[model samples]
Target: MIQHFFLLLSIQFRSFFGAVANEWENNRLKLIAGAVTLLVMAGAFFFMFRGLFRYLASLDADLFGFGTALASRLFGMALLAFGVFVGVSSLITGNSALYRSERSTLLMAMPVRRSSLAASSVLQSWFNAGWTMLLMGYPILIAFAEGLEFTTVYLSRGLLLYPLLLLVWLSAGTLLTVLLGWAGGPSGWKLFGGIALIAGCGAVVFFAGGTSSDLIIQEAPGMQLGGLQNFVSDLPGQSRGYWPHSLFLQAMVKGNGNAALILTVEAVVLAAAALTAASWKFLEAWNRSAVAEVRYRSPMFFKDGGRYSTVFQKDLLMFMRDPVQWSQLGLLTGMFAIYVINLGRFPMDFTNPYWLAVGVFINISFSAFAVATMMVRFAFPAPSMEAPGLHVLIQLPRGRELFYGSKWSQTLFLSVIPASILAWFSTMSIGAGPLLQVESVGCIFITAFTLSTINISTGCLFMRKEAGSAVSISSGQGGIISAFASVGFVLFMVGVLSWVTKKYMTDNFTELMLAKPVRDSILYLMLPVGFTVSIASFRAGIKNLRERVF
Candidate 1:
């Protein structure tokens, strides 16, 4: 069994490397785009972390001289957050690999042990989820080391312990996925459980916010080590009963070797336990999943509607059919809620127009980046996601209208509406002027519409059947190009807004509110640019679809 597992693992590794080699040989552009995207992301993460560490290290004036302690706490919170994220990702990817894939079926029919199959799947899931975490994480650690002047030994220890942390998370997630499959859990129950989990997290964060905010609000010396720990713990780690973050912090940053050893042991034990149990129960889980009834039915939302309406309903139903999509959307929503609530909690004066402008800028920047990323993840693969049914779709009369219109409708509901609402609430939370609030929401709508057109256009132009899933499709060359292009547009928009605001808006809220002429000028510049880009992108994408796809 061990040998077979090793062979399976080797095969997985070869498959990954071989795919990379094939892309490098046949589609070098994809390899280059991916490399450029990775470097840009790494650089961004490094700078962001460096800035955060510097701020935490300089928290003496306001945070009561607990700079170092707060920095350590921040480190722990980052690790815990990443761990949880990877775990959730693992559950989604692992479940699919273990039961939903045809390759798994072929493997199960062979003479190999089911244990080997399960073990291989677990390892595969770890690699899939862990690589991103590693790429994003190491840069932060590097920045932390540089910002805090930590020894190289400390950085090395952190690098070593990070994979151990990922192992624990990946194993736990895989175990949960397998356990659910073995228990023959209904899809409804799984959905409900995820909802309950997210809700419970919100409740904990809500309760913790009061206590943590009080420490800062009072301007007491208690806002030192204990207070900082409370803030970090309540937000990420302790909220989920996760302590490895503390262990990693103590071991790596504080030079506590015992904590490091303990974490290592925990990772090993959890991983071994997960592998043994999953392998032992693999047959039963396979049987359970295989025997599960297919209960899907035609969605009746637009059963009797027109062709465009039917396409819209089909897109909506496809999104709803995937539990992973709902879970991810729920997670994004939860994060945004936390972010808006935190904006309200930020210890900054809102009455001053300067501070208000700064807040608005930050809010808009965050929202724009998020919108761009979500577009890449969810919108960039809309056309490719239809690859399996391309033949049927192309045969329809007025197919171009049906396809593009359906995508536009999906973007309106899924991306534009949500982004507009988020912008409205976030700007309101920061107490921006009424005009500024309206402008912010309008900007978000324009941004969302533009990004959706760009990404959906790229999806059509670069539709690939072999990608097989939205996740895979979104990692392609077109997706990378779309992501970068969308982000660059957002940066340009923000720059224009900032320049206009600084050049025209006055220091007082009333003066800024009365600056209608300046606001109108800014809108005139932005609106035309946004519409031009959207129109151009739509035309290009439609041309590609008509020539190649249709």
Candidate 2:
């Protein structure tokens, strides 16, 4: 049985890695080039973070008696954030692994023990969440670890416990999945997304607001020896229910060998115990889930949306039903809200043309970059999203242009309209001139209009019907190409914006040097270019899909 489990896990790992490299099969040269590009990007970020941490280490926190405790606090806070992210990722993915997969039903009817089922599910979640957590944790950990000379115990605990910590989150998340199923029934566990979203938004708002306090505390002068303890204790009391996290901090900051040894033991024992407990209930929980009875749901806080055209309504409903998409969009909206709210609050010197121009420019470009990023996620997947329904649509409608138009209108309603409002608010948030405000909105509108059409058109051109699952679809080569194209287009816009700003700046601070009308003219010129590209792309794509599908 154990051998069988291990074999299954090995296959699962292969599938996951193969999915990541799914684009590599076609062209050897392209694969090599991609590998190089990814490595370069990773290396650039890693070294950049390392340099920042080294600088932070050099900063004299002597004012606050931060001498030794500063490292401990940093270690604690960073690990806590990382662990929360891992846990949520595990919870979301694990829920899908347990509930959404038909394999659960198949396995349930077999002779498989609940223990085996739970163990396999937990391991799969760990595998899914592990690489991401490691990649994110490593640069921060490695940078900090450099300063703390690695003793044998520190090396053992640090290397072992960080991964152990991730395992703990996976195990706990799996257990939560079981409980949610038990309480809510089959699809009941998905309610976790709602809870997670609320918590995440509150966290963003708090995090955004707390930066001022951190800055103040760091700068405040109070360098007596006792103040160090006071400073550390001043933080809100942490529950420390998660021992791996606590031990990680202890090992890093206090250099406690006992804590490290105990942590290693606890991690191994607790991992087994949690999985066993979860397995104890897994069969019963899954049986209840398989029944598919309708459990009562609480009243929704918001009313449903109004009806649009049939095609648009269908796409809108489809997008709303997917928890994965909603969660991502919710996070984006929350972060954007935090940014916009803080933009008005963060004081900028209007008297200094350099600061004023640069601040407003960054704020405007930030809005553009943000909308494009959101579109890549929401819009670019348009074609792949239709794979399951493509045959049905072809048999019924046979109107390719109508279908594409519906998507275009839905994209405007979903992505473009909201984004334009946000961009205008962001521009006004920083007190830009009336002309600048209008220009900012037009630029975003052009970006949204072009990107939306581009995504659907390019998506149709490269759509992969064989990639049945959302994860596999996004990993497909077509999706990758679409994303790269969107990014490149965004960069072109940012570059143009930067050049115009620079040109205007170098003209002796004369407001007339770059006249409002001229600036408007240059931006207006972009609309025609965007219009030409969108027409060509949209036409070719609809033509191809119509011929191929209908």
Candidate 3:
């Protein structure tokens, strides 16, 4: 049994490594970019922790007597919350690669006992949890105890208990995954679960912070430390009595021999029991409930042979039927709502050029993100979505042109309209001169044109062998390409706008600076040039698509 567990772990590790390595090989530049980002994160973490430790060391033991307890509790909750958040996201996302794979299926069919398989899966999950905890939580724990003069017993307990907290997280995640998988149709339920999970997490943070604040108010009245120190010192207890996190923290702080022994035993027992139950029931339940089917039907044909309206309507229907398409749009809607609320909070004087520029930039950022996401998830996948039907499409009369036109029309309608609306709202709210407003709108259209063109061109050029699952983050390289293209386009647009604005100011400094009409006129002239270039890019993309053999 032990050998079997180890074998399974080895296989899973190899599989994970291979998948990641392949992704890197195919998209080396993106992978390098991701690595650089991770490096920056590590550097930031190190500096943050070092500063925290130095600050803690400078405090007097008498004045900072309460600091130890406060820090421990805050660290514990952070660990707990991080664990829970990851667990919840995994559950909603469906650990198909880990849990619903051929290897797992074959292993289940073997003579291997359920206990061994469960143990192995639980261990894998725990390792994942630990990596996550180390990345985000360990710094806080290490910094909190730095220069505090803790005993070896306390240090040992802290070390031991960190993994145990991670195990608790793994247990929670495994249990939730099993339950959600058993429920079936993860796509339908995941949205609901994800929203609920995010909302629940926000509520937990709010209440926990509020409770801690109340506690500090009651206990340490009128204490006036600096803002950062005060925030750290006044945090709530890590957990209530007997809570897993609290027990772990207690072992770390007090380090009583008996307490350590009891917590260790309790953690092991709980983890073992959960794993056993999940293993015994999960596979059977999943097998029974995993198969979810979606049905699609073509629309009824009209008497006039449907004509142009028929083809457009068919494409529209197909778009509506796709869960991925709708989901992307739904996410965009949520993002837009958030952006509007944030915009309302900006302290902007409508007449100020600085405010106007800021508002225009924000709108551009929002539109760019939205359009990029749409293009990658929808436009780039357009060819693959047609699948075997693509052969029939090529054979139809003027099939190539119709095919390209339909996709282009869909992309335009989907990307341009909402982006224009957002740009208009931003410009009007900022009270920019008419010319500047027109220029802003033109900038948005230019951005959309460039992004949409890149999306289609890439979709035609780099066709995937299979229709990748929508939920997987690293499923397609096209998304990374889209992201890169969008960023590049935005930067280019910013440069051009800046140059044009600077040139106008240089030519007519006093009038451009003080007169709205002059500023508006300059912007209006720039708009047409920007619009023309964007249209040229769109045509170039279409030509590229026509030339490609795909």
* Best candidate, TM-score: 1
Query: Candidate 2's residue-wise lDDT over 1-550, tens digit each?
Result: 5865675567677877796577566566667765665565456556765565555455434434343334445555666666666666666666666655666667777776656766777777666656656865765666556543322224445766688777766665665666676765424225546436434633642343122133233554543334334444433212133356666766755567776777767767767876676577777766666676543443333346433365565665666666566665776677787787787665455556666577667886887778777776677677778767777665655456666776677787777787778888887777676655666777787788888887888778867666454544544455656666776667776766676677668876555665664365455656676787788878978888877752
Evaluate model 3: give its lDDT: 0.58
lDDT of 1 by residue, 331-358 (tens): 6777777887778666666665766777
Considering TM-score, which of the candidate structures 1 and 2 is the better prediction for this target?
A: 1
Identify the superior model by lDDT, candidate 1 or candidate 3: 1
TM-score of each model, paired residue for residue: 0.85, 0.71, 0.60
In model 1, which regions exceed 4 Å deviation?
Answer: 51-77, 150-153, 185-242, 334-359, 429-431, 500-506, 509-514, 517-521
Better of 2 and 3 by TM-score: 2
Regions of model 3 farther than 4 Å from truth: 14-95, 98-108, 112-177, 189-196, 199-280, 291-325, 347-357, 429-436, 471-475, 498-550
What ranking of all candidate models by lDDT puts the best one first? Answer: 1, 2, 3
Tell me the TM-score of model 3: 0.60
